[model samples]
Target: MGWLHSLFSPLKKLWFRMHSTTQNKGRGIYILYEDVKSCPYEDVHVLWSILVESNSASLPSKK
Candidate 1:
């Protein structure tokens, strides 16, 4: 494997570990490697929605 991939592989595993636990159950979305980096034009909107939703969920709610 290339050095760059070797570097990212561990990070990806760590991300999955953090998000796939019971604490985050039902709140995680998994995308295949190919689909994420080279997503088709038709699927761009889907990716955008996921990003927006993740960001919104991370923000604190106003009183």
Candidate 2:
């Protein structure tokens, strides 16, 4: 138990740092449920990008 705690302590700190950085940059992660025909070049990016739905139907309504 002690060894496990020692090993994971550093990992936990690293994960927190990464999560905080992502939040600070105002970037979010998402999973695409289906394939899309096309998307804007400026919106869709490989990493740390803001997800924009080309179709309004695919997006959830804000209450």
Candidate 3:
């Protein structure tokens, strides 16, 4: 029911946050590329580009 979802959603999120593994608690990003050997070069390039751009934007510039 909708009411049940509303009641439990926050609790579920809290539970996961409290119980998450060490690997899931960091600021690191994890990308899963299944069948990496067969993945297209363009796909990898695009992902790399987005990550680079986002990281650069988030970093503070030095004067």
Candidate 4:
């Protein structure tokens, strides 16, 4: 499974970085906003994926 782990390693790192960066500081909302504003284009897809995943997971499912 080494290849599988390697395949996901970058995504895992991105998630950890985003999570830790936001959580470690006070005023997370403002910090996240600033980070997004300054974030590089290459990282935007990863950020968007994280947002979509979290948002969908948090919402209640329709019956």
RMSD of each: 13.1, 9.8, 7.8, 13.1
User: Top model by TM-score, which number?
Assistant: 2
lDDT of each: 0.74, 0.58, 0.71, 0.82
Please list the residue runs of candidate 4 whose C-alpha ends up more than 4 Å from where it truly belongs after superposition: 27-63
Candidate 1: give the clashing pairs. Answer: none
Candidate 2 lDDT: 0.58
State the lDDT of candidate 3 residue by residue for 1-63, as single tens digits: 999999999999988877786556442444343434346788886787787699899999999
Candidate 4 per-residue C-alpha lDDT over 1-58 given as tens digits, one digit per residue, 9 for 90 to 100 = 9999999999999999999887677576567767777777868858866986997999
lDDT, residue 34, candidate 2:
25
lDDT of 2 at 20: 94
Q: Give the TM-score of candidate 2.
A: 0.39
List the pairs of residues colliding in candidate 3: none
Q: Compute each candidate's TM-score over C-alphas.
A: 0.35, 0.39, 0.36, 0.38
Off-target runs (Cα >4 Å) in candidate 3 are: 1-40
TM-score ranking, best first: 2, 4, 3, 1
Error of 3 at 29 (Å): 12
Residue-wise C-alpha lDDT for candidate 1, range 31-51, written one tens digit per residue: 443456577675876777788
Better of 2 and 3 by TM-score: 2
Across residues 13-44, which tens digit of lDDT does each residue of candidate 2 receive? 99999989988655422234122224445334
lDDT of 4 at 13: 100
By how many angstroms RMSD does model 1 differ from the true structure? 13.1
